[model samples]
Target: MTGGVRDKDRDAARDDTLRRFLLPIGAVIGLAIVVFGTAFLYDKNGAENLLAGIYQLLGNNAGATALRNGGGDQFVAKLVLAAMALLVGVGGVWLLYTGVSAVVGLLSLRKQQRIIPWVFVLPAITLLGIYLVYPTIATIYQSFTHGNNGAALANPLANYATLGTQDFPHVILNNVIWLVVATSGSVGLGLLIAGLVDRVKREALAKTFIFLPLAISLVGASVIWQFVYAYRPPGAPQYGLFNAIYTAAGGQPLDWVHTQPINTYLLIVIMVWLQTGFSMVILSAAIKGVSTEVVEAARLDGANERQLFFRVIVPMIKGSIITVATTVAIAVLKIFDIVYVMTGGRSGTDVIANRMYDEVFQFNQPGIGAALAVILLIAVLPVMYINLRNLRHQGVGA
Candidate 1:
């Protein structure tokens, strides 16, 4: 009886092991069926046709006819494509990670421990290589080539040389101005607002109001500000908010966005407005994280409110301050939407990104566009390095 019991236990262990192995295999196969089935349906127009048939069966002949005519079909196709993409993207990753993890689980304990992290990380690394690394290298190579045909440049450095001439210098300067003014203004104002709001009774409400503008897209914000900066000629009723206020004070209604020198600054104001809230939220958290004991000690040591804030609070949150400044600086450097929508890079308000877009798409100067892209990448690298280093120093990702 004891011998039979031992044999039964051995058989049960074998069955349990088999179940663990079979279960993941079944899950993986099932996931593959769903993901691939979705793809197949989308590729063959089966999903769209089915939707159209449903519309017809529901007595919406017009909707069915629209679908047949490519309008509603396109919409249905898009929905299917989106669903397929999500399934393939998310489901594919899950399948890969889960399968690898299960395989690793079957290995020896030491081997599993050694291989598990790679099982988790290799997919991300592979994706980054495919998307980011390849495109970047290709762009750098393309920057040296002429036009869309990829012909060799007579002068390999011609594209870079072109940036130094004509209106490019002014555009570069505008980017620099944006970098300085927008970054400093956003960080400064955010810090100020964060400090003041921290002392207020209704902190969340005040922050909600200040943080609201950060929710607007740069394009949407530009569109809204277009009305605020909208200009009609002098002696006409000013429709713009700023111009209306100016004209009400008996001053001439001036074009805010089209006016040079000031126009760039006005554009910077929108960025500052959008970014200040982000800065405030980050700095506020940092400020709150500062030790109250240290603050009280500073007060006991004869530090006034201003001195305590500047010397104590500011220094404690210096990492956050740097992070916000660098983050805003990066955004300012890549600024295109505001300039593109508000002025179309006219009136001397162009920046690197907008110029790159015009060069590539509008002007069809692929070489110059690639060159500008490389230059922009070069500019952003240092700021990224600084931010990363600060994060490391703060023991993030340690």
Candidate 2:
């Protein structure tokens, strides 16, 4: 009789725990369902009204088609709408977190503690699978298919075979040139600048000016440099800065974009200019983190400034340097804006990304574009693997 009474008490405890957990969850879910159902029933015109407002603000009535694409006129309205949307989004997110936390807290009684983390992470995992995994698989499937439509190619590997062609060789060569020059040039220049300017008066001012380019959009930077590299006929007034300087020095006005290897180098220079500040800032922080006592010991051991820098400082900050170089290299590999805006991939200045764009859109060869994209992904995988390993090591060491 006593054992039977104990079993009944245990059953009662489990039921109580389950009830406590489910009550809050059921309440929140019920509230959410009612809110969504009401919104769907009442706010049927929300999307249409929002789009109409946007259209009106874009001057659809006046038919300013030319000015509509310019964006300067509609900037204020777009900015206001964007700000309002952002505020609403933030408020919604906060409310969601509060609701989820309250529900989870009430439900996290007894033996359900292990499941709470998975409950919180389930939404993020679902989003990642939907956005990232699905697209990658789809892209890979499209690589071997014919054109934009879902038909098999005559030969399964025909698109891959295009990588061996003459034009693709030039494209690969240009990417390599950019990868080597821009990555090294940017990191080297950034390191030198960082080392020289560390602890100097007005250091923040110098760093800010260097980092100013990072604030500019890539397309904007390309546009700014186009005027610098502009070319005209010799007799025509040389309006381009480079051409003007050349003419002043009694040199012929050369079309920088139409030139072969020189044009490729010039484009790489622009990338280097844009990325150097990034490298400098990262490396400077790493340099400053080096132990001062280690530096003092090295100096006491008769190490000169050059020896200290090369032997001590560089070794200490080697990880940051690698990180900076890899980042710049990836940017070089995927560079499209500079080439697209400045040269349109003309005159043997085509990189893989630019060629992929041309193949996909200009020539309507989606298979070839997908093939190029897969190849780029394959190329980046090893670099990414190395970076991840380094990060893991850093984490463990810390």
Candidate 3:
């Protein structure tokens, strides 16, 4: 009789605990549903980024300092819309903050107080808002402006008017060609070096030599390569490496940075030289991380060295290879220092970043620059997505 009474008491306690858990879970689910539905409605109208709002505020003129003539409807509508967005923008942020706070409390229940997690997270949150979020919002606002000089930005498609011209497509193709040829070549060489030095007795020494270029800042690397490609009109004692080689071969030293398509390739050489070391180091580390037991077992079999490397090693470190490749690709995509230092976006070496720089700094066109920056970000997004997916897969496997 006593044992039966104890069993009944335990069952009642379990039921009460389950009931308590379900109530909070249900409330959380309801809150999630509401938040998601609101987000869907807001995101549908291409309402992302602050540029559109700033454009609306400026009445379709870039930095006119006033609404364009007869742009009141646009302004009034935007101002009204801004007023409406307040509930979503500000209120949503507050709700998110509250939700995160509650989650922190839940997670830190074992600790002294739930507020400790917030204290730890506060620095990160502050940095994100200031460095990451604020800059992103500011960049968007800059996009709606006409120029740095605060000229009235009228919507004659001045930023995108380049699409109608031939050179615009050429700029795009030049950038594409750079991404493909330069990035692929660099990564390929890096892989070759990494594989060659993976098990070498002087692995550290090899890595140090390969990674030497990474120590140089982008500007410093560019300056060094500028000297390598430096031309002295064929009779200036052949100070540059290329010129010296040319003179040594009984040929006139060519002005490499001034030459057309050749200058593009020359700049590419600098990028490759600088980045090859980085790729080699990362890929070498990945290669070393391969299971030694598996490698030894493969060696004990009748597998030749070639078969062992490609058949066993490559497959295992495929994710690392891809990570390094895509990382180099993104680096090549954002390249500006070399072209900027060497030719200043001239001589047919205008990649997207350099072109964006030209648009904003030289041409004084902010909208076009913003558009270019947005496009660059879009271009790099795929590689970033691939990297994230690869990392998640690795984490799950581990």
Candidate 4:
């Protein structure tokens, strides 16, 4: 009877391991079949056909014509399908893994502990991969192909070469101006405002006023500024607020949008105005979080207000400052709405994002747009990696 019991135990362990391996494999196969059947029922080309059929069912024949004339509704449909596929694919894979893990947990307590966390966290990780990873790969690929027909470019490097044109220098220059001024100015102003308001009687009211600009969307803010900078071609009653004031003060009614480097600076001011509030709020929180005991100790050691702010408070809140700066920098890199709405990238006001837009849609040079986008990505990745590293060091998300 003892020998019989030992044999039965061995058989049970073997069956558990087999189930652990087979369950996930079978689940994946089953999911594929379900997704495939869903697509196949719509059309023989699976998901692609299903997407087209769905578009047709919605009375969108524009896609059929636009596909041949370049990307249009069909391109949009495919993009939607791609996103859906990413979500579905990720969910299916996780479900397979989770199901297998849960079944195996029935035999092992350690596996049970592992299975629960995986089930909870898997959805978030999958969505992250779907949104961040897939678009990045697709954009990189699209950079090398023709925008119109998706044909291989005559030279794979041609798109990148176009970005090096004579006009591109102005674009690069404007972007650099925006990066330096907008990022630094916003952070500095934010820090200053936060420090000043900390000891004020009506601190909440002051902060609310300074932070109001950030509440406005970039496009909306641009529209607001448009009235301020509007011109009436000098001596036509000066309709624009800025021009009116300038003419009254005996200054010329300048065409702010058409002016080269000046227009860029003007655009940067809008960004700084919007971002300063965000930085101030964040820095103010960090300031409040600084240890009062340490601050008093510094004061006792003969530190004045200026010295304390510079030497003590600044050092302690450096991480928050960097975080705020990096966030603003990313916004600067991808800035489009203000430039697009205000100047439409005309004159010398064209930044990288606006140029990319003009290349893809306006100029029908998708490859160049893709290349520009890739360049923007390359510039941003290092900053993001540094930001992530800083956050990790600060024990954020720990």
Per-residue lDDT tens digits for candidate 3, residues 86-109, read 755666555555554444444535
lDDT of 4 by residue, 1-398 (tens): 99999999999988878677777676666567547644654552344555655667788777644543545555565575666666556665666565555455555677678677776677679888899889788888888766454667877677777778869877887888889999999999999999999989999999999999988999999999998899887648888888888788888889987886688888888999999999999999999999999899999999999999999999999999988998898988899999999989887788899988988888777787888889889988898787689799999889
Model 3, global lDDT: 0.74
- Model 1 clash count equals 0
- Tens digits of per-residue lDDT, candidate 2, 133-160, equal 8978888888877654445788778888
Window of ten residues with lowest summed lDDT in model 4: 40-49
lDDT for 159 (candidate 2): 82
> Could you tell me the lDDT of residue 222 within candidate 3?
86
Best by TM-score: 1
Candidate 3 segments whose C-alpha is farther than 4 A from its true place? 1-114, 141-158, 163-166, 292-303, 384-398
lDDT of 3 at 199: 59
Q: Where does candidate 2 have its weakest 10-residue lDDT segment?
A: 63-72
lDDT of 3 at 156: 40
* Steric overlap count per candidate: 0, 0, 2, 0
Segments of candidate 4 deviating more than 4 angstroms: 1-127, 147-149, 297-303, 387-398
Instruction: Report the Cα lDDT for residue 291, model 3.
Output: 87
* True lDDT of residue 254, candidate 1: 91
